[model samples]
Target: MKGPALRGDLVTPSDARYERARVAYWAQFDEVRPSAVAYCETPADVAACLAFCQDAGIPAVPRSGGHSLGGYSTTDGLVVDVSRMSRVGVRRAGDGITAVVGAGARQVDSLAALWKEGVVVPGGMCPTVSAGGFVSGGGFGWLTRRYGMASDHVLAAQVVLADGRVVRCSESVEPDLFWALRGAGGGNFGVITEYEMRPRRVPTIVSFHLRWPWDAAQAVIAAWQRWIIDGPDDLGSAMSVTAVGGDPATVDVAGGWLGDPAALERHLDELVGDAGRRPEIRTVQEDSYLDTMMAAFGLTDTTAGQRQWTGQNPDAVIPRQHFAVDRSVLVDRPIPLTGIGEVLAAFEREPRPGQVRLLSFFALGGQVNRVPRTASAYVHRDAQFYLAFWVGLDRDLPDEGDRHAAQTWADDGFAVIDRYSGGEAYQNFIDPALGGWREAYYGENYSRLAEVKRTYDPHGFFRFAQSIG
Candidate 1:
């Protein structure tokens, strides 16, 4: 196998005209570029790159899609571009189905492989998100209410640590790293090459969408708080402040039920029945499990090597949501409207100076909640559901006003969030702005994680803004 330098072209900052390499997912900032992009094609290539960075005393980051909202994967140091390693393989073991997929694998690629077998795995809702980052960060989605987060179904991992050694971690061997790698995230301890995942059988379900006038924003938010408390585990629901018309003022509360159409209809009928004006659209359709997953991603089918994106994937909400934002708390209870106002204030200040959209995934007693906090590296056990403040920026909006609004909205939103969750933040979505992010990302387990970090990377070869010290 070829080394890191040969598998793909390397771009260094010393070169004068490499403009494209300097951008990230948000691409709003100028200094947000990597020192060198090490394009790797195989497991051996990844191992060699880590070794090179180790001996040379150069810090390294791992990039799959460059889709990270926090831009953690693309550090100013060396980056291992694993996007070229997207090879997917599957095997059926008796009644069970096991797939061995590469780290660069995207959601659509892996879901299609599983779909061919008439099976499903809990993955990201976005077609473009890479499996490595998605799983490493506690992945949640429509199927999450049924089988739990994507990390929960991880059976094993093929990991490459900082010191250039390859070891397989599972329930049976290297169990500590096994726990960390499943949910803690990649580049935290090592580079994950393959994931042995537990696949779930797809179900026939009903999907419902209720698009309401902008005036009904408060109504939908309150209704969801009540419905989710007693909703069925099979019914996975989320609400978004999406732009349905010319001006971005419409709200869409859409949910997926893993059961029959009649059952889902009854549930929606009971939940939103009190509201006088019901949504009249018939966007709901019943299909096979794979089709539903594709629909969840907003894509239909795929051609040869080209990626098919639905462009309607649901993303997590951040309180202060601007084109470029920071991470906040993950609370157990939905804040009162009076408090939500502060959140909206920050959202309005997005770099594009637009209103913030709040997205919530209600926790309706699922396998994820049943798993104890200490069971894995992801310790979000008491959480009733996941809350993400998702904001979209008008690329053409004036820079000064947008930044002002975005900052005010973020500062106000964080104030209220502090009242509820002890200033705890989600590590996965954090920006470089927070103080003691090691605690927010890892919680009380930060010290232990640092020990793990020291054990694996004694030379401090893989440091970053939020990495465990």
Candidate 2:
């Protein structure tokens, strides 16, 4: 069947820019070529694209930051690229501030804009991630412990539904749709045009990083789990074990505290002291909330187009281009010491040259758990921490065998941790290989989300491999 005419900028496979337009952040998905890429400029343009896809019986997917780890953003039919729709503005509301962010706005640009107003919306660390997917998929960041997930701050949204109808949803209007939008709204129910988010006042923060030798992995992991589980809400941290190619593994802990430098230092001292191993490298600095965010993004170097602060070099922006696969699980209880050793052993079993392996534990709880599981579409509120196993091969490597090996290692690593994960997963880090995803991602909320899906997207128009319906 012939597809209907699309009004927005359409790039076919024959177009000169098709190759670039069709590419996603993860190179593993580059092989999934689409019929065409449509850059939607406005809500009307989005409607037009969806209408065309429906008329011609073609699948349509929305691409904002192109950061879907599961490659759900790319489709074989039509890709609605909203990256060009990025725009941000602020307004005063009673005693607080609210920012109207375009769905396509990147995290860095959004942060820079909001910083000028001395406010911020908790978001992911990656700069190029779009507000659309990040917020809808339960976004988290430095302020997460204090303010909760990014989805919690959303006040309203402008969504273009499956029937090509634009509607406004919020607590007072289209409340059911608004509830679904809070967490699992990723490309399933509609195309979001804009988000009205409540921003919190930027507070002074102390950012720190500490590193210990790989041999202390067990001790550090044990100590970290005990400390962070009961840590104050003012603190948020992540512990990771990483190995690049055949290099020795290293354990690193990094985080930020929304308080005085001296207090943070004391806390860090206790953390290290508990682990019974002094870190070879420890660095802590007090900076404005904006600078701390910049540092967290690995943007402390001078670079073109980056605004320079008084004390630091221009921040360097790294493009998201790599061949990687990640799988994650939510930990409700502390993992046993033997289980932790088993996880480390899996990484040691397959040490592929030129492949990077990372196992990360992101601290959850605090205000994130204060919200009830049934309050919104995000159901992992009771999880203590999120565990992810990531494997990345050099994109330049042409050997398919090496890529397959890296993927296998990642899969095996996840299996080891899955045994202790309480069978819960974060919806944001969607995994394609995961079985029983409906229960894993949404839990009891799946039924309601499916009902919402049926109401708004009865035809199953907006869908991917693991879509809600």
lDDT to native, each model: 0.66, 0.86
Off by over 4 Å in 1: 1-5, 8-23, 29-31, 243-248, 274-277, 280-283, 301-322, 326-328, 337-365, 396-401
In model 2, the worst 10-residue window by lDDT is 307-316
lDDT of 1 at 301: 60
Model 2: per-residue lDDT, tens digit, 1-469?
2343555688889898788788877777888999999888899889988998887888899999888988998999999988778888898769767899999998888887888888888887787789999999898877788889999999999999988899999999999999999989888899998999998886678888999989999999999998899889989899999999889999999988998889889998888998999998899988888778877876755343653222122353465456887888999889989999998898788688878889999988889999999798988898888998888876554478987887788899899999999788988888889999999988999999999999999988888889988
Cα RMSD, each candidate: 4.8, 3.4
Deviation of model 1 at 207, angstroms: 1.8
- Give the least accurate 10-residue stretch of model 1, judged by summed lDDT: 312-321
Count backbone overlaps in model 2.
1
Which lDDT tens digits does candidate 1 get at residues 284-371? 6777767777667656664534352222122322112126454456666766777666554544443332444444334434667778
lDDT at 32, model 1: 61
